[model samples]
Target: MWSDYLSAGFFKAFEASSGIKVNFTGIDSNEEIINKMKASKGRGIDICSPTNMRSPQWKNLELLQPFDYSKISTIKNANPAMLRVGHDEWNFGAKGSHWLPMIWGTEGIAWRTDQWAPPRAGDIPSYGDIWQSDVKGKTMMRVHSGMLGAGLYLETIGKLEPGAMKKAYDGEPGMRKTWQVVTDFCIANKKQVKLFWNDADSQKNGLLNDGVVVGQTWDGPPISMMNNDDPVQYRAPVEGALAWIDGMALSKQAENLDAVYEFLTYCYTPEVGGRSIDGGKDDSWGGKGHGYNSAVLGADQYASDDYGKTFGSVYPYKSLANLWPWPKEPQWYADVRTEYVNKFNAA
Candidate 1:
């Protein structure tokens, strides 16, 4: 779980009512949590917040239990767009039996507009922005071997054939070629990269301190910066933002299933979900400000409050066509990605 999601009073309010103590953990990325859950056999975890893309892999490992509608009373509030992304038979079962959509958002470029602006009038931003000569030596990028990096690569090079999502994770012959291209792209631009970051603070502060003119960030940090009058911008590139939804999953070995179920239901309520999205503590990114949007149905009501949008209040929701979740990857693909990640890090 991300601290950015579960804000200050979220659990305190829940505890005051339910008298249940939350033992929480913060995970860094999509890839790391999967490995952690599998290694622990999910011994200590009750509810897991993985993206819809992870449903297939979780199913393959039997890491999660099937959902039963009888246990969830709040399912009706989940809207269509939120439930539909990265969804499938295993996690959703016949009728969404395995998971509940928790938080959803896009990951893409966050740039310093004061330092880096469009090269020409009416020129839209794209993944190619980091490679521009003006922004060189002042760029950063996401360090991922999963869908985020792979999707950007495929989309950037116009190599996203149909089923390209699976190929991104599964190491199809196409994956090798696609990854090679991305690797080459990164290597050629590595000199421009100040750092490849996984820590949240580094990403947010890098932009805040003006360390890099352009780089990768989630929708949150940019919004946070702008709220404080920092001149940062997060936008969908010409290639489109990398979309994802993190949901609550049940661990097979969870000891207190009933309590965890109740907790999930409690959290789904609009007030709690809203507070969770817009929390008491301010991270460098959205919190007290909504860093990004959430999948919880009523949670997004704060769009009217308007965190830091100068273009207008609230994010202009993109077309469903523009978003893509991380592909559900197979084990073989995961292994190949690990190798590629190793090579990438070594480089």
Candidate 2:
């Protein structure tokens, strides 16, 4: 989506105005991009969008250069969470700076309002709820490893702990509880889930056409459907939702550092930010509103204009509690995936 827009007159205009031509390239995965950046030893691309989970990895590889805030005046207006300067031991150098939060969202339950009410505080539904006899064969889940890990954590540990909560990652009793819960839920509710979706459109179809009453998903799809007048609702559950950060960072080797800074400044503008929210379609998981909220543009007041009566009812990025920072450890992703795959296959 961003690539298409950048290729349009947007990049041309940006370049003409800033005297910097931005070169955009697409890579398959965060790991691939990181590896490519490391191979260059910090001289590859000017700007990259990698998941926040990779911050520590980039730091370790010395693939990022500290963001020069003095040159980017818009940094002051950004949400504090979006700032790059910070001291996190998990990041490389045991101290790191240089990745700016570009967008964010939570992984949580989305249910058919016609069939269910919002779960009360402390009563947010769990992965186990899908296994309840009443909803058997009527639930859906995301197939992504990160999302599945969160569901597993909620199931086994019953709630999120600040640090790594997986037994494989942290080797703690709480992690054990989380794994147990997820494993039990998957085993018992194997027949309940209609399907596990990897894409946003498939999940929407399952909910709208396949009679799926509950889904473990991100905020965009459910909210998009509801905005289009679908009988669905979503929320950040009491146990807290799995949050992630999608950020923009400069390549240590990027030749057009000035262009990268210009692009970052452009992205922070209200015009660019508003367009991002307005670009959301029902089938896409993340839309303009999702990006705007992640950029911390206050509440989602633009909904009424976008969806009419269907708009105001859907909440997007309203709670910091709902935003779970992605784990920084290198093996976190592989370990969690293995645990869930083992549990699911065993069941």
Candidate 3:
């Protein structure tokens, strides 16, 4: 897993300098993280990364605790907007932040550069493009998120009301109504997708080996390939990229308090945070960072030469302002979406 590689890289760097060994267990999904933490009562793990949207549920479940920011001087180096998320959104019963922003990223369009390009030069592609007739059976997507992308595309053509997808987060009825249209659209155009990707490796394989010409993929995989001079490019879609922040949270039953704080301080250092963006010179793990933005201020200054060029190209001409952050999701919402996703897949 890319996350495991990231944890390994961090462990190697921190261990070499601090003389403290860190053990890592990689999990593929948020559900797995919740399950493990719940089963252990958060006893075994010192820290775990969960998306910002999961903060509320996790906090309500008493799985995590607020951080003692006094020990983390590097907290001053984080972006203020991101800090507000920890302070305002994830502050569930605690007066302080239960979550600390780490890696932030987006999910958008990626295509084989030699085999495909946007319809017009200088313009970005749209989620609707994935279902275009020309690319039938040559596209790929993860079903759940892809369905949301499809919903956005439907609104663009007057097939659904504007903002219908975002409105679904209001409650269960809205969610079902919105997802019903999305599910129908996906079932009708299911033939367009060559394969469904569930992980980073599957996404890369779809493009590099499985004949996927274009895909709705997380920016990391294709950007990493692009850095290696592979004929692939990832960009924000015309509707907007789906954005998210993945953060570190303290386990409720955490025993290694000193080590947890030490690791947090190490992660926020400018040089370390920067290396995470550019995937530092560590050859053992393919020397590739996760290819996402870091939350730490000044971290970009320490990134590789390719970082600046790639950033400017991928988010050109004010596209950054258009990022659509994922909203906080309740357990009920997740369960409802799972039903629709299952229906679309089963179709």
| TM of each candidate vs. truth | 0.84, 0.69, 0.95
* Candidate 1 residue pairs that clash: 67-97, 67-98, 92-96, 92-97, 220-291, 286-291
Model 3: residues with Cα > 4 Å off, grouped in runs? 1-8, 280-286
Q: Go through the candidates in order and give the clash count of each.
A: 6, 14, 1
Write one digit per residue (lDDT tens) for candidate 1, span 1-51. 864566546667778879998888887776777888889988888877776
Model 2: lDDT equals 0.58
Sorting all predicted structures by lDDT, with the top scorer first, yields 3, 1, 2
- Please write out the lDDT profile of model 2 over residues 1-347, one tens digit for every residue: 22222323445546676877655665534656666676777575677677666655555566666677677767655667555423343244544456776656566778887886544553355544555677878888764443454455554553544343534345445545556555665666578778777556666887889888987876667866765668887666544567666677766677776667777787766444444444433323234333224463532332235643333333333445444555655555445555666777656
Alpha-carbon runs more than 4 Å astray in model 2: 1-45, 84-91, 94-96, 114-126, 144-169, 172-181, 209-211, 279-292, 296-333, 336-339, 342-347
Candidate 1 TM-score to native: 0.84
lDDT of 3 by residue, 82-167 (tens): 98899988887756898888888899999999999989667588898899999999999988889999999899999889999999
Runs of candidate 1 exceeding 4 Å displacement: 84-87, 92-96, 120-123, 145-171, 280-290, 302-304, 307-321
Worst 10 contiguous positions by lDDT, candidate 3: 1-10
lDDT by candidate, in order shown: 0.65, 0.58, 0.85
Name the candidate, 1 or 3, with the larger TM-score value: 3
Model 1, residue 217: distance off in Å is 1.5
